[model samples]
Target chain A: MTNRRKFLRNLLSVTVALGLSKKLFPNLIAFDDYFDDDEFIIRNGWVLLKSDLDSTNDY
Target chain B: MIIDLDTATKNVKTADYDVCICGAGAAGITLAVYLARAGKKVALLEAGGFEYSDQSYDCYKGKNTGMEYWGLDTCRLRYLGGTTNHWSGRCKPLDEVDFMERDFFELPGWPIQKSDLANYEAEAKSVVDISGDFTAADISNWTSGKFIPDRYAISAPTRFGDKYRAEIEVSGNISLFINANLIDVRLNKELSSVTELVVMDYGKKRFTFTGKNIVIALGAIENARMLLNCDTQLKGGIGNQSDFVGRCFMEHYNINYGFFSGNPKYWKNMKKGLSLYTDSQFSLEHKIGNGNVSMSISPDPPTGGGRSKELRKYIRNNVCKWDEITELSRKFVDFQCPGDGILGTLMEQSPNKNSRVSLDKETDSFGLRRVNLSWQMNELDKRTIRTIGIELAKEFARQDYGRVQLASYILDENAKIPVGYHCHSIGTTRMSKSPEYGVVDKDCKVFGIDNLYIGGSSVFSTGGGTNPTFTIVELALRLAKHLS
Candidate 1:
């Protein structure tokens, strides 16, 4: 299968599997990918649209 | 002369309304237009004042740009039109994969379809002035299109402050309240139905806005923070029984470091594209993923005279036409941001429970507790990046665009990723059909909080590879129909 087809197949299996289990998708858990590498740069660097609450006053 | 939540709720005029909207943004405005035109009594509450200030865009310049954000410590603002006043205006709809329930990652799709949103597409189109039905634009001369064999699309970057500001204020049925911030939700013990919403203005910080039904159109971060902060009523927080109130946060992961060969007509058009900065779109099909990878092009280093000159050594020698020569550089230019170009790139990040907002006892200047975000994305997020980067690079060579200089995923271990808002932060107070996984139901109502509804990008389940404003408007209209 093309990688695209494989991905589609994977998506279908998830639906079928989840449907078979019929259990709810697991809810969100806290996330923190503080890796020091750049491979996952996009993942770790997403700032909220207006993320100022976390800023400090010391500056 | 001071009115608190208790005093106002008790003594204020209790009026009935068909629908009450919140957040005055793309979603809120669409809901107001739909409901009020239908003769429904609708009140839209926004925290920021209207867009008539001299300092409106003065905040986006430099260090001050950080202050214009939403949080007290951040630079975004709180206002009638929400953060969109400063939004770069890139707009795209979530793709079908964004609606799929993918198992490869923690993200899940909504129990909805792209077709379900078909009715509102026209409305979204007319609002943004998108002329045609086809979202993708044609791009054939570019080398990237040679192998990828796909076209680019003309995306609409709707400036809400300019576009819908007057329409919302002038609408007879839509009562838009400026300087109104939703602080809390009052409800009975059953926790399913909410009674009254607690609000605050700038001075007193305690203003009461009562409604038969309430919609929280506050942006994503604030949406979760508002619900989580309303801890007085619910034990785990309103509609937060699963403790998912502030979890599953997602944003488009965007980074584009590539070179361009400067073609003047193409260069001029590319320069024009860059000047708008926040309003272009691209697609990257990830062979390994359920959702195809798409990119919103943002303003990168302009691909004019010198920048392309520096890249001539890397440029491919085969020249077809002089026009294609200048234009193809911006095409190969790695403006590979993951969102519409108005604000910046936003790539869909699969949800990770670790990426979340946790409340601290420390309050904002408004007495709201600070919500700390511990955002994270995993290797799956990189799977498409490497594939797309190589594929796009190959396209550059195939079309003889250049030896395209796209960035390598590998870099210094200590390198910090370039980050910016796509004007699309979603998934904090996610939408689910059931309470087990989300804060809001399919109709965008808080699962257990009866009178409370959420209308914003925050209700998105899986952050798709598109600009979110168009989808935000579509989803808000869908939620409104669920009520009337």
Candidate 2:
């Protein structure tokens, strides 16, 4: 637990941690709660969990 | 690795190097370390720096030594670590499914399989520090039924250059540079052999690096872009017959953001398992019917879904409002998704000749033409993504374990759209059995060109719907051992 926490702290600075953290924490993480109200998707990469799975930009 | 006067000359330096490599990113550096460890002279030429030495390939990724040059979510770095510097380090091996030639799709499987690259993967594990024993049979045995307890897991993703930085630096035969950038590759009059590698510094100081053997470790787009730029002697570009040089460009396609509710606590699974499996690749085992696929699963919520049921209840009942009930329920939904986070792919397009990178009139920091990326998704790719999306939703629904929802397609074109760009791409200089079909041969040697080799994801013949780092490192190590 101690080691995992340290790893998480390091990972949070980068975006990969968002997905990785959710994977590690499962139900414990709420994306809405992690950041402040000022936070928007522009400065942050969205967790695209339900909106874009069907659309594609291949062309 | 000095920016001496002869550098602008390309491939005819006075230094004594047993091997001279171009593009000092992941594969080039790995090969450099191997040659050095084996007591051979090695000189590496990089087009960028330890991430910031040259501004051309910077992806705005702040330095984390080993991860300094990790490939970013939407950009490529022409810097020291190659693309691995910015990579998410989510390593997984290419499986038998990824290796099988999909007759259903116009693709050819690799001559080797999960078994062929095992030893290299072992070495890769060491190169990038991570835990977990990656074995093919272990993954194969996962679904064998009664005797097998579903211990199905995957590969450990580790950043290669960061993991092996110290080893590369201390080696006796390896030499690395921070500011070196490949400008032009001077070839012989025959236009078949690479005689000199012309490099330039941020100061415009030209350098020409020469060696008996040379390698191109530049990433997929840059590899082809560089070749196409070297049109001084070769018409139609070097090794560009059949217009194959910039053809068949591909990448893994991943479109996320679909919802899946009704799983009660399915959110928990996606979060906890992100770090659970450390195999070579992630696939659903039976994803081929929809046209060659690989997968990973995760909960819809962030920070993992372990306490999802509890958190959802707290947010819904205790936090505040009856009006926000729908929003809270949306949070409780059990949708799961995984992607190459930075260049997170939800789909991988088949090799198409049209999707390519070509030179535009606009120049970059080094006065080179800005590489104009022409990425096009054919109907085949769109059809596959939609088909696979429905199929996967069905599987998640069929499991009786979770509900898979598809909504984005239900909206109008101008509605919330999802752009599935996995930028973890391959091809441009593909490998095939012969020169007629590829840029490199079985050993990653560019066809007809003796001593010129290409490693990294750039040489990939097909883009299986999975991250290519594990496979890239494995191939680098294979080249290392082969050259060692």
Q: Which candidate gets the maximum DockQ versus the true structure?
A: 2
Supply every candidate's count of residue pairs whose N, Cα or C atoms clash at under 3 angstroms: 37, 70
Tens-digit lDDT track of model 1 for A1-59: 89999999999986786454323311111112322433221211221112222434111
Docking class of 1: incorrect
Candidate DockQ values, in order, are 0.01, 0.02
Decoy 1 TM-score against native = 0.68
Candidate 2 lDDT tens digits, B391-441:
444444343324433443412222333445555868778777666666777
lDDT (0-100) at residue B235 of candidate 2? 73
Q: Please provide, for model 1 over B1-484, each residue's C-alpha lDDT reduced to its tens digit, 9 standing for 90 to 100.
A: 1112222343443246666665777778778777877777787776656644423222222211111223322434555566665655555566555566666665556867778887887777776667665433233464343132222234445666567667666776767666566667788767677667666655554555566788877778777878888888677678788888878877766655334332233333443332111111232234223222332233333245665554443442322224334333333443222111322234566766677766766676556676666666566666644444444433433443323333323222233344434445678888877877777877787876667888888888877666677788788778777776
Worst 10 residues of 1 chain B by lDDT: B59-68
